[model samples]
Target chain A: MTTAAEFQIEYLQYLQADGKAKSDLPSFASDETLMVNLYKTMVQVRAYDTKAIALQRTGKMGTYASTLGQEALSAATGAAMQKDDVFAPYYRDYAAQIQRSVSMLEIYQYWGGDERGNCYQNNPHDFPMSVPIGSQCLHAAGAAFAFKYRKQNRVAVTTIGEGGTSEGDFYEALNVAGAWKLPVVFVVNNNQWAISVPRGSQTACETIAQKAIAAGFEGIQIDGNDIIACRKIIGDAIDKARRGDGPTLVEAITYRLCDHTTADDASRYREDNEVTNAQELEPIKRTRAYLTDVGFWNDEKEAALQVECKKNVDAVVEQYLNIEQQPLENLFDYHYAELPANLVEQRQEVIEGSL
Target chain B: MNELTLVDAVNQAIAHELASDPDVVVFGEDVGKNGGVFRATANLQDRFGENRVFDTPLAESMIAGLSIGMSTQGLKPVAEFQFLGFIYPAFNQIVNHAARMRNRTRGRLHCPIVFRAPFGGGIHAPEHHSESTEALFAHIPGLRVVIPSSPVRAYGLLLAAIRNPDPVIFLEPKRIYRLVKQDVPDNGEALPLDACFVLREGSDVTLVSWGAMMHETLQAANQLSEQGIQADVIDVATIKPLDIDTILNSVEKTGRCVIVHEAARSFGVGAEIAAQIGEKALFSLHAPVQRVTGFDITMPYFKLEKHYMPSVEKIIAAVNHTMEF
Candidate 1:
């Protein structure tokens, strides 16, 4: 018998769930200021998610997906990316979006059912939050193609739920990325549950990261709850991609602590004990513990950070609440670069009918 | 000026754009060394190099999604699906992303892409290769669905679709890809997108069609002329943002109309044209508008393909019925 091929998936972790170092820290962890900033951003995203859920509960916003337990993954992914590189993010990637210069107010407006929210003041090349499962992967591949074709030193980053790995678009994206050796990173937030479907039922594969192996690329698993591991692994993948080393899939294994969205009730499908167990291993508490133990954070500073995040979230919510409804013409204005003659007449008809 | 077939004209337009615009890229399943299955992109990869003209993995959804991503990044990507029927896999990407990008982003980003697919029946090909499903895309708001009949229109409208600052579904009528040739000037002139072309002028009745059906519709008009029935032949170049004004004007002048298409009869482009004519030109219309279209069934394999398509005799019969009425 002859063995034609062999593959192995590597698992990475820097900090254990108890806030103790499991291995030597990556170089980025030595940067106290950068670590603090990432920690602060994750805290800020949690604060924003809390307010967003409250808005939905109060009927002020649409159904909001809570990024409760996955903040480390989102924040680390965002921090690893450069400003010029494009990001195609899924719905629960508010932390990444904010780090890319998309404002909290804009995200609020987006969930509030307004199109103007997608018109980011900065980060114009980043794709708007794609709601469809697994579709953004291919978009990232396309962006990578453009970067390679133009000889630009940029990489495209995209994130999807572990469940999205089952989609054909996901595999198609990986295949194309590998075939073209595109500059892109695929980060799968293995948050255990996709809505009500658990990771075990989503696929028979042992790890979501291994799916990239079939596409002729490397795939690795990381402790998604450990911000140090998340940032280091994702950052290395992005750097490798920028240097034209092809694509990599990083499976950040974590747990979804909250219901899929405000509209869903996790209790209906998941056991209370499961949620209880997952809460103990959530990303924020361990990161806070590590930060505090390392002397980069203290009770006074934590209180101040919480206060600051609350103040920022409150200000953005106020601005979002006060924003006037977009004009009716806005509906017709952006449908094309120049409105055609028929559309011109149709717009007039709609305007007159409104009158 | 060079005599070019419709497919040749398509190649010329894409080649011209690739040469003119640094951002214009061409790619599909076999678009690279193979020059596409129909050779519509023949010699494109050779002329433009691999970076500009390349082939992608056989995934339609990826093709559409990639085009959207590239277009947002200041590149005008001309992505092709091998066949219209095969484009169903990419429907989600096309309808949800490409068609909605500009509107959803409020103009911050827009997809400037041309999703080209050879569409319509009459080619003696197997199933899935011959189906005119332009209505599916025409129903999308931000997508411009354009089809060209003759070589000249193929060259001009394809150029327009590629240059238009929005997503366009450029459906080439494969049935007549090499059926006829005409002198097409490679002058980079683009025909108007939201307009129709008046092919032949007459007064008795209006004959409305586009794509492969335009071949049979024109033949029917000529046969009608032999029967002392003058017909106004109008090619609806752009199906979406349809140039109903031209059809209306012709219908008003003739007071009778017949629309022809090879796509399924129900909820098709023909139905939209007929409805529009009824809406704006009801008083001018002397008789009920007639439609000669394929049955609402799967576009059958080659053996039964002709029976399923709208033949010249069926179009003539409908026009004669309208004329008699």
Candidate 2:
């Protein structure tokens, strides 16, 4: 049931459950080497997720959250934007960060409790991973406000879950963005759960995107698991804002196919039927199948892509796991322009106490 | 020098900062054309232009957030909260964002912004207008809370806050804004936020306080001096990152201290000063750190505001008692 929009449903089936891009996407990638690089990045990011889960099982990371199920959504949405466009992601969007040159090792380091993991050689084209619910939206809006004030065409995109819209900052940021007509694309990744609370408990509204109208912006909902649909949704919104139409609220209706995080056990609160059904609509698998029907399927190419993806991940894992852990003194750093006396005292005590 | 009241000095500071630094912009509810609720920002728009001084929407968070946005982009912002009580709506942005922006950015971003608000009891104002919540902000690491007691200090400290490279919380004691006047230095003076100004030195005891309470401390000092008990009046211009050297040095010399503040007695600015003295100057002191502070009640409306505040009587009582120990 494709509408007049550019989104295609069957094209969602070309990718495998394992995250390989289907054959049809090759054309989109071939002409734009950027897309192929984006594809490889998605695969590696997924692998990184898998490794993080494994690491968390043994106490390497503290309460790790996953983008395992939303890899395609992040990749497709990120792929639609260029480097100059700003992305403000939640703690769960390392997939988007990787494409922006936020190193895998840094992600590992941050999940490992190091702010240095957050440090980037470049701007990473993203604001910091916002930990507080919906706070990043304000930062995104502020960046867009800055861009608008300077009359820049660069779009600032921020992501939040359904639960985030309930935060006061969410309403505040939305009001500011809409009032100022800032060039921002707000993607509410309706992942259906905030921690143990389900989306239904967050709001009575059928969709978060519709809330945008109340805040003075047009709202749209799309199947987040459908790559073509996601790309079309994000691309159109970006274009509209670039032409100075102000902001748009995009609700990418996606499911958290995996448990919310490594620490989560969906079996406790979520029914098995729901997970199984969502698994069937995994964005990567749908894209691969769509490519196969479009003459992009071949066993050799699939094997090669897997090897190439795994090789990159393994190399990164080696680099990440082996990077010297952040020194304890680093905890006291990065908090003030001038290191206050108390912090210096605390740092010294920590060093001495550790000794 | 201008024969200005404390409120006039604040208005003067806003006008002077706006004139001196093109980057220094001032805005809050009714700050434009209306000139702020207390007229602290009166006539700034006419002098500095709307771009340099103007009114913000009724939203406190937006006012603070917009300031953060503006400051990060190179504008020096002096954001006002129409009243101390109304400032809580923007507390999150102030505490979580503005306070931490510099440290979070690894010093790459310096939030040279000042939050100006009239605080403490005395006026029979609304519940939120007569609050002494500077202690909450002073406790936060990256923030420097400066409380001005008189016209002279207000002009100097307000200017220094603007030039200071960090986010400075300039808490204007609403009660004292028009209560007093003084000979303000011609060009004003810059006082370090981490230092205390010893207003009057004595050997029997030191009276330590800031903001509105400093007036009461001075009054108490005058009262103590009348009885031949030498009293040192120490004005803690800056509350956070307390001026430990000055505090300890005074206590060591006088061997006694009476901390004063208009906030509720429990965990107010006085508590920090007392605790620090207890920890660092305990052996040097002749008695436990005595604290004269406001009653632990929501400030009453204007009729009882004076009684609700810590007074010369209370400070005199605390100082007299400390002599027993």
DockQ of each: 0.86, 0.36
Candidate 2 C-alpha lDDT tens digits along B107-175: 545567888888877767766678888878878877888987888888888888888777888888887
Clash number for model 1? Answer: 0
True contacts kept of each: 0.85, 0.19
* Docking model 1 quality class: high
Per-residue C-alpha lDDT of model 1 across residues B77-106, encoded as one tens digit per residue = 999999988999999999999999989999
State which docking tier applies to candidate 2. acceptable
In angstroms, the error of model 2 at B301 is 3.6
Chain A TM-score, prediction 1: 0.98
Q: What is the lDDT of residue A285 in candidate 2?
A: 67
Q: What TM-score does chain B of candidate 2 reach?
A: 0.96
lDDT of 1 by residue, A178-239 (tens): 99999999999999999999999988888888888888899999999999999999999999
Q: How far off is model 2, as Cα RMSD? A: 4.7
Could you tell me every candidate's TM-score relative to the true structure? 0.99, 0.89
Candidate 1 segments whose C-alpha is farther than 4 A from its true place: none
- The whole-model lDDT of each prediction reads 0.92, 0.76
Q: Given the true complex, what DockQ would model 2 score?
A: 0.36
